[model samples]
Target: MTLAFDSAGLGPGFADPVFDSQSVFRSVLNAVAYPGAIERLAHRPGAPEGLDPAMASVVLTLCDLDTPIWSDAALSSEAVSTYLRFHCGAPLVAAAADARFGLIGDAAAMPRLDAFAMGDERYPDRSTTLVVTVPSLTEGPQRQWSGPGILRRRTVAVAGLPDWFWADWALNQGLYPLGVDVLFACGDAVMGLPRGITVKE
Candidate 1:
């Protein structure tokens, strides 16, 4: 499928009509390797208005026909959705529980973490992955984080989140392997929290 990115109404000065997604994938690995540290983001500017370069980069890197995606209501537009379908070949999902990748373009609109798919005991790796795009990446009101990816307990103050997610995240930690993972994107930077993360209030 050919994407008419030029006519998609993206802003001026966006070069490289099609972005190379492998770079972002590699960056994701680095981010996961060192939890609590922000990983630098890189993307071609001028992506469609609703779709940030960082979010788009992740979509490109991970999406395929096998991946079922659930887009946030904020970015559930025909143009953006169609572009993703054509470019990434990702199948849109009607139910969050059925989605392998849930794209939360607006952090505020994100559903409760428990509402998403947490893998079953038989296949703990089958859980959904949330891709949350926040307005800022800087450390906000710090919260403790510790797990496999972390060297020690780290503090992160994130923006654009409600009180309930932290509560849900805290609960999810007890579920062990039967929980969802998360990836946070801001600008071109990305970070991750696997189900293993033990968050402390």
Candidate 2:
């Protein structure tokens, strides 16, 4: 049997799998807990063709064999697919509804948040977690956010999102505990937008 390690355009994975993942995991947690605060990723994993370094680190930290991922056309290249399979052991799914995690290469072209797997009332934790690649986290239209993890209202800006993204997020917020969570990546930083967060544009 010939074992192939040909990853189309995929680059190297984590330099220190265990420690790097642990560090990335902490950043992810801080992002989620602080909602709009930008958390800089300490790990610099090799990113695939269409993915950014921050998003790639997030996938490596959170995805695994148990997670099913959905990616947009720009991010669905063989390089990204093979990279995820080899490093994270995550399976790729065609439909967003079936994915535990969704990777969006172009935030402006991303599907509606409702298109993803919104967990049921019984198990709201089963909803999908979206990892969207954006141009910049600190350079865009500012929005005020208030939610569970936030101490008070926080103003933050995220570039490269569609014009209707705020509107769509408003609708998603109405879904309460049954909606999908999102993490926006820019360069080596990430910002979380959990379902509990409410955004005012």
Candidate 3:
């Protein structure tokens, strides 16, 4: 789909749109290809004040008019809404369950994983992809992660999450091919936590 162009409504995105988006898209692919492995984000979009750099880059690279977005309390500011609308032309949804992409800035208060779209049994790929911004990538409880993307098993620690997050992850993972996937962003780095990944605490 063609991205809606706005000359005056939103802040500018990539300087070199095609090349820059390709670069960021590569990073996003790598993140999902190697779950729990941090991929350095590329591009420097003129993101809104509260939007995280990595999440913003990912949104610009992956989102379009077809995707609907949901923003958490910390990221639902008017500036962010206007920016995303103008740059991405994506519909902003009020309910988390309806969003194809959820931008979360407050991990502690974000909705549970099950609250978002889990897709249908037949079209499991229709699930939501959460892009959550946290404080650190390596300063939380360590858990052993293993799945399609992992070589054998990888130990990962993510900071700035609520205590119940892992419990939600466990349940989400139990859904096998039908569940929500997550992209954890810290600073300018992103790490994937696909539904296939098993986390052993």
lDDT of every predicted structure (CA atoms): 0.78, 0.91, 0.89
TM per prediction: 0.88, 0.96, 0.93
- To one decimal, what is the Cα RMSD in angstroms of model 1 from the true structure? 3.3
What does candidate 3's lDDT look like per residue over 51-168, in tens digits? 8888888898888999999999898787888888877889999999999999999999988888999988899989999999999999988999999978889999999989899989
Ordered by lDDT, highest first, the candidates read 2, 3, 1
> Between candidates 1 and 2, which one is better according to lDDT?
2
Stretches of candidate 1 off by over 4 Å are 1-19
Give one digit per residue, the lDDT tens place, for model 1 in 70-121: 9889888877777677667789988999999999988876889888889998
- Candidate 2 lDDT by residue in tens digits, 1-201: 999866556678999999999999999999998999999988889977688899999999999999999999888777778888889899899999999999999898999888998899999989999999999998899999998888789999899999889998898899997899999998899999998899996
**Residue 45 alpha-carbon offset, candidate 2, angstroms:** 0.5
Of 2 and 3, the candidate ahead on lDDT is 2
